[model samples]
Target: MDDTGLLVIVDAANVVGSVPDGWWRDRRGAAERLRDRLAAEGVPGHPGPVEIVLVTEGAARGVESVPGVLLDPAQGSGDDRMVDLVAEAGVFFFFFFFSDRELRRRVTSLGADVTGPRAVRPAGGAWAPRRDG
Candidate 1:
């Protein structure tokens, strides 16, 4: 329905913390799993022109770029990187894994939509508009 392009930013650590599956025990594995899930071929229900980015603390150390995704390593905190991405992503539906309310407020202030750290269904993920209720 919306014609705007969407940018989905995944806070790797925050998303891993969303579930109590002990993802912290295997950080890389969890990140990889999330990436794979997002990259799953032929999945249904993704809206138009969706772009996914994964932000993690020190996770992008050696990795430069992913084929269908952008990997960002947080110098201090992944939240900062996420915010920066939202700010830089001009005119796109921005969605990020929501863990901290403060960070959510900051992203909304920058006029970017936000989404959840919840389990991403095969259809797609949950996202909310930045300005509209």
Candidate 2:
């Protein structure tokens, strides 16, 4: 299958919250680190071709711009924005990292294929799909 039609939506806060490394103490730093890791992974084209969007609440205070990585700062709820993105991003293969049952249900209701928890590396790093069961 052509991977070009794939779209990835990252729940920045969720990802940060998943790890117990005091990420909440420094949200901006955590986000920046996540963005850097994601950029290195080459999102849309990693493992296959896919467009990626990183959704976060508030401003992206410390994150830098990276090609193929769209930073979306939600004014209200990131989940709402994610739903909107899924609605508008066409019939591409959608993947999200939210672990919330309701949010996951919402994403799936929108017909997105979701994944989770694994460490997503840059282009040259290993790519292993996170198993959620």
Q: Global lDDT of each model?
A: 0.65, 0.71
Global fold similarity of model 1 (TM-score): 0.76
Q: Pick the candidate with the highest lDDT.
A: 2
Off by over 4 Å in 1: 1-3, 41-45, 58-65, 119-133
Collision pairs in model 2: 40-122, 41-122, 44-50
Model 1, position 118: C-alpha lDDT score: 64
lDDT tens digits by residue: candidate 2, 77-127: 988888888888767588787687888998798788887645453333332
Question: How close to the true structure is residue 29 of candidate 2, measured as C-alpha lDDT?
Answer: 68
Q: What is residue 26's positional error in candidate 2, in angstroms?
A: 1.0
* Runs of candidate 2 exceeding 4 Å displacement: 1-3, 43-46, 59-64, 119-133
Clashes of each: 0, 3
Expressed as tens digits, the lDDT of each residue in 98-127 for candidate 1 is 678999999999987766776353233322
